[model samples]
Target: MSDPNRPGHPEDQPPQGQPGLGPTPPPPPGQYGQYGQYGQYGQYGQPAQPPYGQPPYGGPGPLSQDEITWGSAAHWSALVAAFVALAFLGPLIVMLTKGTQSAYVRRQAVESLNFQLSILIYGIVSLALCLVLIGFLLLPIVGVVWLVFTILAAVRAGQGEEYHYPLTIRMVS
Candidate 1:
């Protein structure tokens, strides 16, 4: 007999052992889609752990030597800004541009900018204090501290170590 409502005609049934009229069986345990085992698709299963020396999930890995060099340069560039009387602009630019590429560079740029901003505030306070003539003594001390700390930051950045500026207000994180 012929059944019009069925997928195949009554005379043309699906091959034996196949799900002719029954629900399809689940795939064998531990086996998934075409890729096979779990974690094959980065989904529907636990993700594979990163090998040793690799960055942890969502964290940046170690910077290369060239990245360290550029990061150090970002710290040192603040000296140019200081000489030009634009202490924050240079580091700000580096932080915005190169920061997207390397986390280390971004960190160095941000620290430099924060330190520069602090120096600017100190310079302004020193100028105001000049009315009492005590700023005359404090201004030189501030300048020396800025120069020395900036150089030390550059050295630390070149060594691929994180550096936070002392006496900085840390306006940027």
Candidate 2:
């Protein structure tokens, strides 16, 4: 019932005389089809390892979801600490802990720490300037900048992006 003139029809193809030029050979032994019995997983149900047999070197790998959350927390925690008049404490704590687990989190915490330290320094300088009447304006400006930057950093970290504060003195690597 097949049409003889149709292209790629079984009846229109050349005869399979040589095995090398013919259809693919059946899989050997216990393999089931192209993927075999284990499918994408390697033998014995274990995941397939990288071909190089070693994890990729240089730089921290992709940030996981947990890392991203912790990274954001590293920034937000600064705000919480600020209420207690210890702006550096939050990020410092986060850095000492979660920072060890993720480079991204470490970076966020370090940046926050540096920024908080800078703000503290600025506040001290502005308070000193208050004796000369210039600190009256500078002190409020510093407070506003601190609030704005802390929120900005937290939002950026939550979005899985990095943030750098302006006029910050980086004390930690």
**Prediction 1 global C-alpha lDDT:** 0.81
Winning model by lDDT: 2
Largest TM-score belongs to which candidate?
Answer: 1
lDDT of 2 by residue, 1-173 (tens): 87899997877676564434765343454553244544244344333443455444425467688988998898889889888999999999999999887778888999999999999999999999999999999999999999999999999999899889898998888
Summing lDDT over every window of 10 consecutive residues in candidate 1, give the lowest-scoring window. 33-42
Q: Tens digit of lDDT per residue, candidate 1, span 37-99?
A: 444444444544444575544367567997898788888888887788997888898888888
lDDT of 2 at 25: 45
TM-score of each model, paired residue for residue: 0.67, 0.66
Clash totals in order: 0, 0
Error of 1 at 144 (Å): 0.3
Show pairs that collide, candidate 1. none
Worst 10 residues of 2 by lDDT: 42-51
